[model samples]
Target: MQRAWVIQFAGLAAILLLLAFALPRYAQMVPEKIADHVQHHLHEKGMTWAGVRPAPGHSRSVLLNGSAPDAEAQQAAVNDLRSLWYIQQVQDTTTPKIIEPYTLHIQWDGDKLALDGYVSSAEDKAEIAEQIRSEFGNNADLEKLQAGLGAPEYWETLIHTVLLKEIKPLPSASVRMVGHTINFAGKVATTQKAEALSKALRPIEEKDYHLAVNIIPLDIIEPYTLHIQWDGDKLALDGYVSNADTKAKLVEQIKSAFGDNAHLEKLQTGSGTPKHWETLISTVLLEAIKPLQSASVRMVDQTLSFAGKTDTTRQAKALEKALQPFAAKGYATSVNVIALDNAAVVCQREFNRLLTQETIVFSTGGAGIHQESNALLQELADAAIFCAGTTILISGHTDDVGNEEDNFKLSEQRAKAVKGWLFRQGGVPLERMKTSGKGASEPLADNDTEAGRAKNRRIEFVVEGI
Candidate 1:
């Protein structure tokens, strides 16, 4: 009977030893499991910065550490941990993140939209990111934002309104919000669009949001061209000017010069004109072509050209002298001037008499006028002066002594040579004369004899526009 009692007591002692060994280990394992489950629950609730660990001497309780974005977030993390089945209590040791002068910046540089700065919570950040993705597709950068405290009231609403309504519609734009102040800047393709944007943003300013808007309108012009015409009675201005002020100044100058007989033909305002553009146009108008009977001046980018008519060789020479300064300034100038007098029929008769009395001569087989023919050419130029208002056609003839093509070219060169001499020596405008060649086609006598061929190889002057 005593041996049976001793065996039962030994079994009880073995069971007690087993219990003593496993209790501490199982207690340690229970706290670890609870801590792990609480940590996972906090992470799932977007409290990634919150850490969970078992409270000392308390298996069912956890301590939440690390920084939360705000007091509300810290409390939410504690509540999430406490909701776990194995966690009976949660002790939070977290601080709310505080950022002074909280700011949000959005930049859209024509192609890409970038979001930067801070929001109040992850929810707000996610909402802003989703909005950006919806509007900009893959052309957005939203990684710079962080959740924190100190954001202004209704910050999310203000950001959303500015992003989707104002900044999204612009080609290039930016929005910056600091505390209660908002600054919006954008670029538009035209003045109308800029005005529209300003109007659209007026409500934000009126609501006392401390808004400042700077919308710029682009005014770029390519291949700038300006044309001015004067038709004996009235002056006309056409093509592009730089701005309203420039166009107004030009109209005032034109009216002053032409005595109020000026016309405006679709003169537009733009940018991107050459340097000294206004100065060039003004000089050409008031100095170069003012005294002419009829004229047209055209400026294509850096080049300036004009054509006109005057009543005297003196006036033509003066016009050429007036354009010298512009030419010296590296601008291309094409000047054509015609000197026209009203006595056409009388000048024609005088030319016939002069040519019948003497013949103008040139070098053999060349276009150079012979020195001996100077006296005869001087007489012919003197006669041509009276017919300045008419087109004097100088016709040259050659005998059938060479190729027809060669003779034809030679005759034309001789005619031009005569015109050149009249311009250089007698002060006649080159545009007042025309030249032609008749290579043995029109014979005054015949090509069979020397005297006849000499007569055929002569020059004739005919005055037209009588």
Candidate 2:
């Protein structure tokens, strides 16, 4: 028995050496060998072979050959090819996959499926993820997810063809969330984009878009920097389109001046608004005369100072009148809109207009005069500037935009709100002024669009006998 076993081992060793040599020589022949082998077998029953391509991440590729005239022949060829040891896998395939544009490349790391591809934005990412789920139904393994479709190369091409969509990315708009607030800090070409961003983010209940819209007194016409940030319940903002405090004051003051019953305070802090900030300060040149156009805003020791080339006396007086309501509303006020003289400059522009004309003003729905208004008023007072003690008329007017009565009421409320802020709050004597509402009866322009309507819905100075 021992001798027979030894002879059998020697025979096996010789056979193994011969087979190893034959396999090395045959490795090169597998492609054509396999293709020919497949075709010949299929031919015995009448058939042909079609296509082959590289399998991702491997030197060996898959070749799908043999076109069968009948379903049975097709299935049989596929089964025969798949049964071969040299063939990793096999399936029927069609042609013309050459014309696709987008390509998906994926890496299969054992732990997590690393899905990496160029996606334009939030929407694009969501869409592709959804499409993948729809096609493969969420899966944890490569076999179930991408590989389930076919060879890796085939799957990559298919996804690129069907999944990707070409879209010009919306320029990056910087936003930061501080606490419960969102603040914007960048420049977008259009105002609609800024507004849309704010509106769209309404889904998060504990947050709001607070903008620090920068505007120069005359250098530019449009807002320079539009900053946005998000917080737990609000928005924090910081940017540099220039005129930082000016933008903050303008938004808050305008909202307060117009009287937004729906007052909300959500803005907080950021940076990177530089270009827009400088552009904002330039806008000051757009509306006012040459002298006032150069006016600048500065913050020192928590106070805002206005510096410009306007008249020392007139601008100061205007500032006093403008800030009166905010002071009355119990805000710590200050201002200085004077010519480049030794004295501080504080120009009272809007409030005085309201007092004299009794025009109604409408707010943009979130905030009112805020602290800056009061500080502005205090500045005027400290500058010893005061408007004539005329029985100033505070009138609120709306354009022919919405309900006339509502506009009328809004106008009245706005005027009265200022009066309360000025006299009852800022300490202006009640007897010095009164409020009224004129609903869209006056038009400075055609009330067909926003600019026209805005002109029409102004709070102006209509002199009542002092």
Candidate 3:
């Protein structure tokens, strides 16, 4: 019994000796083994493993941070890690934080523009208000009451650029936020302005942000005014018109009514005009005025008034009769007529007016006149003979589309051509006509559009010693 007990003690000692040698090595290998397994699993699932490390002084806990190309791969990596029996707890800090949506709202009343709702910060609200003020002028009142919060930094520049540079001026506008998008509604001054605003906002739409914009034009009851001064040989028109089209129409009427016998100095602005006021001038009153030494006419708010000295009672009667239609349509007219005077000054004045009224149309990019201009050329020749002693000034103009030097040369050639035509065809002496060229200078209309360019390309005539 004593020998059997001694043998059991010896076996227990041998087991203890084996454990003492193996336990230290096992502890050393545990972390390495866990790190290898995790890295291998993430690699198999196309994930990026930053590293795996045991918490210092803690045998079981581990902190992991890694990334994957997609959510599925991330989930697979997490699953593979949790499957290990040795791992106790795993915490992940690699998920992207979800960002909530942001919004801003703005409203305009009378001359005041009010900003409200959420912006990235107070600085952002002030920035937006300043942009509005820059475009809307000093009279516009700007109010800001916005909540300060975080938003994308790029939004500041984007909103300011669109509002200040692209959008048209408005009397009233309102802006509101809807989800991750914006909604703007406003009253624009004109349809053209609204279209311009739409075109400017097109780039913002391409960025995946949704936009809801509504623009309506204000209805202005009182259209712009038209004022004209017609003397026997000289007519000067100055004031506002509806648009380029209206200006062109009025110019045509002036030319037709006086022929090339009157001097015309037209300076008019292009705004939107009243409905049919131009029709009254072209069709009725201007057509009826026979001959006058001096005339002043003001057409405004459906009212017509004229004060002038005519050569005959017949001329006075004609003007009064023609204005009767306007009177019937709630138009009020005051007419003043004086005695007849057919002096040499009137003849010279008529010749000067003719020169201003007529435009010698030419072929494109050449000095040759259009065939349709023959009648106008003949009238010009007759006027030159009527005012034989006066010098006829033939001036040429071109649109701003070419080199300045080239344009100048072209204008000179065009003026010389007209002078030669008048001398040969109209029996006007060469000494009686002087030619000059004004290349793209003194434009009667804007040179931006095709219609305006056409008006710019013209031949003007002026008479001296009238």
Q: Please name the candidate that would achieve the greatest TM-score relative to the true structure.
A: 1
lDDT of each: 0.80, 0.44, 0.66
Q: Arrange candidates by lDDT, highest first: which order? A: 1, 3, 2
TM-score of 2: 0.27
**Residues 51-108, model 2: lDDT tens digits:** 4443333334455643333344445566776776776656466332221232233332
Deviating ranges (above 4 Å) for candidate 3: 1-106, 109-191, 194-223, 261-263, 311-315, 339-466
For model 2 the local lDDT of residue 174 reads 33
Global Cα RMSD, each model: 15.2, 21.8, 18.1
lDDT of each residue in 159-247, candidate 3, tens digit only: 67774454435777777754447677887777678777777776566655677889776643355556677656667766666567876
Q: What is candidate 2's CA lDDT for residue 218?
A: 22
